[model samples]
Target chain A: MEGDIASIGAGLAAIGSGIAAIGVGNVAGNYLAGALRNPSAAASQTATLFIGLAFAEALGIFSFLVALLLKFA
Target chain B: MATDTHETVVSACLDSHGGAIGMPQLCGEWIPHQIFWLLVALAATFFVMSRIALPRIAAVLAERSGTITNDLAAAEELKNKAAEAEAAYDKALVDARAQAQQIVAEAKAEIQAELDVELAKADAQIAEKAAESEKAIAEIRDGAVKSVTDVAKATTKELVAAMGGTADAKTITAAVTARMKG
Candidate 1:
């Protein structure tokens, strides 16, 4: 029963990471669909896609930090 | 010291969410710092994208449009030049045809004048030859008439002697002259 809340938080954090994965997949899938339609414009939009992926990944990282701190500290 | 502060501030709100007090992200002490950094990141991203990247994209689009317009103008100019050249060629062709017709007319007139002169010379030669032939025919007729008169006078005097008639020269001449006259 030690750090039971922390353990659940870690599980939730894992789910958060999964949500981030879904977000990343959505951004990449949509970009790929559009890129296939017009390959000439794909290069210009690549940086924006990377920025979106990074922001979505940041949320998962914050959730992981919270779970780790709750478990260890 | 940092862990103690984190535990103290987060413990107030942690139990309500079924979380432990040791989560640094939930600590009141870290709130301001995280918010400050997040705002900074957001503002920096906004400024960089709006001021640098967006303007660069706009400039690229504008340059493409300008190139398209210039190419269209150049094509139009070439088309106009082609039209002008065609018109010039047509004008030159028409002028050449007119000049050729004028040359042909002048040559025909010159040839006709020469032919007329030759025809006049031929007619004059024909008329002169006809006059000479008529003069020669008149001289031949006059010589034949004089020879016949002399032969008739001699024959009449011979015929008078052969008939046992005495021939007087004066009478025989008178008779032959009268017959010739009749």
Candidate 2:
């Protein structure tokens, strides 16, 4: 039962990380499109894109913590 | 009874540790595994952002900046062209004004010349009329004097003829002197 729980946690972590990557890719793609349309506003929109990337990356960090908790705790 | 109950609870807590966890604890503490995982995630995020994401963002930003600069340069060029057009328009306006002034001056000069010519012609006509009037007065005085002298001579001849007679020498001599005087 412990092994099964550990494996499930690892799978969930991997899925979370993959979802985060997809979110980052979506943000980058949208930002690139917007930047192409309005080159002048690129500097202003950069902060928003960074914030979006950070939020998506936090989800991966949460998954990594959960995986560690299940493995060691 | 209380001590036995306390011992049972401690044994239960020990059993929960998964094995013989024999370690002298100074201040009761344990390692936090979640914190370690969070640290690893933070490091990975930093690496990925610095190595992959930042470079991509930088490239996009550079391209955008280049485009903006190009647009600004084009706008500046257009502004310069507009300024040049305005200058040309002003120059044309100045030239037109100068040309109009020159034309007005020339017209005024021509009008003055025409007025001068008309005045001189009027003066010449008045002088000619004055000269013709003086000549006419002189001819009328000469005619009146000739008519008066002819009338006086005819009257004296008629009187001498009327007094004529074949008489003595004195009479004849008197008649001859009278005729000579006439």
Candidate 3:
């Protein structure tokens, strides 16, 4: 039971990564909906959309890092 | 509350354990390998994205913009054409109106000329009738004067004869004529 705590922590971190994925999906979905509506305006906002995607993906990466930390350090 | 205490205990244990964990990623021998692979993967991704995918995306965007601009230009041309057509239509309407007015004026002038001719003919007929009436009146006056002279002459002869005086026709005519003249 004592040794299993690390694996449980890693599993929770993996769940957090999954939650981050939902956040990333939210950002990407909204961007696509808006982009498809006004393709001309989409070009100007593409950088902003990508920045939002990176921010959400960074959270997932942080979760992955935490999982790695629990497993290895 | 119980979970929070357990999390703190695990955190303290992790702090004490340092790098001594059970995962292969923490092993010293794999560090170089992981770094090398990470670099390779990053380089490949950057090269592909920048050199291939991004350029294709840029081309599609440029084509879309070109299509939009060309369509807008065509719309502008059509709009100008519509305006020109409308102007021509208005000009034609004005010309038609002017032509109609000109035709009406010509008809009026023609009608006026006909009216003037008719009026002149009527005036001529009226003048002829007036002259005929004057001639007729003069004839009637001459006839009435002759009748009156004959009656006066007959009356004078009767009166002279009744008084036992001889009446000469020549003398009576002369006297009556002189009296009338005087």
TM-score of each: 0.36, 0.37, 0.42
- Per-residue lDDT of candidate 2, residues B29-134 (tens digit): 3334456778999999999999999999999999999999999999999999999999999999999999999999999999999999999999999999989988
What is candidate 1's TM-score against the reference? 0.36
The candidate that wins on lDDT is 3
lDDT of 1: 0.83
What is the full ranking by lDDT, best candidate first? Answer: 3, 1, 2
lDDT of 1 by residue, B37-153 (tens): 999999999999999999999999999999999999999999999999999999999999999999999999999999999999999999999999989998888888778877887
Give the share of true interchain contacts found in each model.
0.70, 0.00, 0.60
Where's the lowest-lDDT run of ten residues in candidate 3 chain B?
Answer: B11-20
Report the TM-score of the second chain of model 3 against its true counterpart.
Answer: 0.50
| Model 3, runs deviating above 4 Å | A1-73, B5-8, B13-68, B151-182
Which one wins by lDDT: 2 or 3? Answer: 3
Name every residue pair that clashes in candidate 1.
none
Clashing pairs in 2: none
Q: Name the lDDT of candidate 3.
A: 0.86
Q: Candidate 3 falls in which docking quality class?
A: acceptable
- Compared with the true structure, what per-residue lDDT tens digits does model 3 show for residues A15-67? 98899989999999999999899989999998998899999999999888898
